[model samples]
Target: MMEVPRDLFIPPDALEVFLDTFQGPLDLLLYLIRKHNLEVLDIPMAELTRQYMAYVEIMRANQLELAAEYLLMTALLIEIKSRMLLPRPIIRTNEDDLDPRAELMRRLLEYEQMKLAAQRLNDIPQVERDFTLVQVLIEQTVAKRLPEVNVDDLRNAWITLVVRAQVNRHHRVTRAELSVRSHMSRIMRDLRGREFIEFNELFGPSAGVAEVVVTFLALLELVKESLVEISQSQPIGIIYVKSTDFLTSV
Candidate 1:
């Protein structure tokens, strides 16, 4: 310690020392490792712990507050140092293969990679930092914009359309499905006991046009198959449907 001279008034910030700042403990650890050219994978635990504790002492001497993270890292460094020096128990397990500094090395490597990537990004040319933006103002000769539509007018138009749709709405009749096979079987059964059946009597007026059409198709199919004969009693007389056997001489 040097003897202080009388009337030596030093300002609080006059003797301020600037230490290398780091983003976190990992950053500081990485700095130490790189500064000394030490291998991250094969780290010398004793030397690394000594230098780290020295930094913590320096921080204390400078009256800088040690963050919880820094303290935790300090404890970890000391623990790793001790784990290396002491003899590990002879346990036949995977723990034997695990290096105490493995976790630290992984974290440091990841942080260094990210830091390098960030440095590369920072080196890229930035818009505002590298150059100023140039702005120009021009007078508009003609500004054309589409007319705005009123919501009330659109609503009134929609209401008119709805009213017209309601007034012009027509009924949608979903006609029932009729089976031709069932109609054919029914016609055969009707003609079984009777010699002939009038075409008008075979079709029910209450049945829909679709059913009537299907019945007519079935009668036509029967005639085509020679299972039934459709013939007029006379010219312009009532049409009759009878079995082909009835028409046959046999």
Candidate 2:
């Protein structure tokens, strides 16, 4: 029995077919020419142009908007065809010989290079892995013990933060009088529904520099009132403010 060959042609109208498959007019033309096994250097513009126009017609008939650039390239192909038909005096210089297909070939090569480069970049590991302390898991039989350095350091840090937030009751006020209690009330009102606020961004351009100092004091009062939590994961790191309003009732 004789085996029949299957049709290899892909139908132009596939559902949800991404236009990205064809980079541009040049890419589409190249695909058609290659599919038919035609010579690139001597591309029969009349046949190629007809094939290209068929695609354009298919797109328009399907209510797909054809880009202006595709039309411009169609005009270019017609112009090149007309130029080839006209018998013009060829300039013969020993130094250079310019092929009519040179420009198109150059563009194709550049596009191909960029395509490969993009593929290579995509293949690279995107999410970088950083070693974390908790990743050190040991065998079940091994009697492993971990150091308590993080706990000790955290305890010392908590003590320091508490000490820093305490107001110096003995110090007398000079120049201007300010109360942390009033500032705390203002902050609580501002953050009633908001879950978080940047520690430094609460102030505006017109805000006096003293507002920063007052805000810090307000934050301390809020932390003490159990209405908010203040924390920094690392020294000189970004300070975080989380609403503990839910914890207040508990």
Candidate 3:
């Protein structure tokens, strides 16, 4: 077994410390180029490759396994550097030959743009990170509703009242004299000065059915004689009685 030397285990340089934090080889390369203000279009491949290998050596010394992507990028940089060092064939042409660094520059530019966009997205307010979920207690009112009644319900109620009235009614027999002529005279006296009287006002609730019938007959007789007139605007409207003498005066 061979033992490694103590000098070989030296810590990475301060410049290479930032390399560990980079996302990928391109990110580290971009950082190095930008730090030195080197033009990406005209990169000094020799210096860039030296710095890249230094970081890689440090990673390997630290026993940190290098990613396949980073190793692949390192090989590409070495190949480009070698190609640049080789002698070129002289040829005259209208169009200029493509630069070896053009592809790398394009990739670097695209990676930089994507990185900036990622940073911007990360800076935006996140639901769980920047803010916490809030719960609110609210009071609400519940309404009490009453049952609805239809026309049939009202008719049933009326029938119940009629039945209850009949059950509570008292039977009595007495000889009470009532005359249509007397009722007519009394109605005429009431209408002497009045302009109009409602037909219902002529018969009160206290008046029995017999009295109401006689009063109604007396009203009809008065209308027949032209002494009183009953006027109603609509078929179901209230009937109003007016004496002919009172009408003539108006």
Candidate 4:
């Protein structure tokens, strides 16, 4: 018998031929069937076996280690091809003959379904890949409150001041000169350096009835001239006097 050389089956560029690697024999078989558009249930065993053997030869030539699963599938393909060539029995029965490709077809269909499901799961939105979660922090602040005063409270305070002045009144008659214009100028000078002043604080206990009256008139004249403002809050609260210059600047 003549011996064939081992190198005869291997191509010269076998090292350069890139083999399409697959997960298993079934994966390679499925790829081939799909590429050729062959029917899964009615596989053409002769053509399939020829192509499969050609791939196995390429693997061997490239020095690629063949797995046991690939070898088993190769044997099954050859057996199916050989059985297709043989004649069948003439005995009639209600059930049809079993297809050789039935098991392979079921496995391929299941694998394809699982592959599609995995792909769908991978496409779902992820925390970092698709979008990121955002968080915001805010700083809190404390509120401030200002004191309030009322008109009735100012009237009561004025009455008290007058009573106190009368209690400390002297019987000796003395004509102490007090001018409303001079008091007005003094009040304006006092208010210029300050923002607000309490209304009762403007008078002193030593100031007699004449000085208090003149000072009160001077304050009224300042209000009439729009130079100062008398403001209050509730029914009985501290009264405040503010310069119109401060109010305007604010």
TM-score of each: 0.48, 0.40, 0.48, 0.45
Candidate 3 residues 1-250, lDDT tens each?
Answer: 2222232333554434434577899997887788768888789999998877877776777567778988999999999898888776687354336667789989999999999999999999998899988989787655322223243543443344445445544478667699989999988987989987876678664566566668777887898898987765444455667888886665
lDDT (tens digit, per residue) of candidate 1 on 100-151: 8999999999999999999999999999999888989986554322233344
- Winner by TM-score between candidate 4 and candidate 1: 1
- What local lDDT does model 3 show for residue 47? 90
Q: Can you write out model 4's per-residue Cα lDDT over 1-250, one digit (the tens) per residue? A: 2122232343555543334346688777777788778988788888888877887887776687788888998998888787767677698454338665677678878887887898899999989899999988877655323344455676687788788778878789998889999999988888887888878777887777778788888998998998988876556666778888887665
In what order do the candidates fall by TM-score, top score first? Answer: 1, 3, 4, 2
* True-structure lDDT of candidate 3: 0.73
Model 1 stretches astray by more than 4 angstroms? 1-20, 137-250
Clashing pairs in 3: none
Query: What number of backbone clashes does candidate 1 have, counting pairs of residues 3 or more apart or in separate chains?
Result: 0
Q: All models: lDDT?
A: 0.72, 0.62, 0.73, 0.76
Better model by lDDT, 1 or 4?
Answer: 4
Q: Candidate 4 — which pairs collide?
A: 149-233
Off by over 4 Å in 4: 1-20, 92-96, 127-250
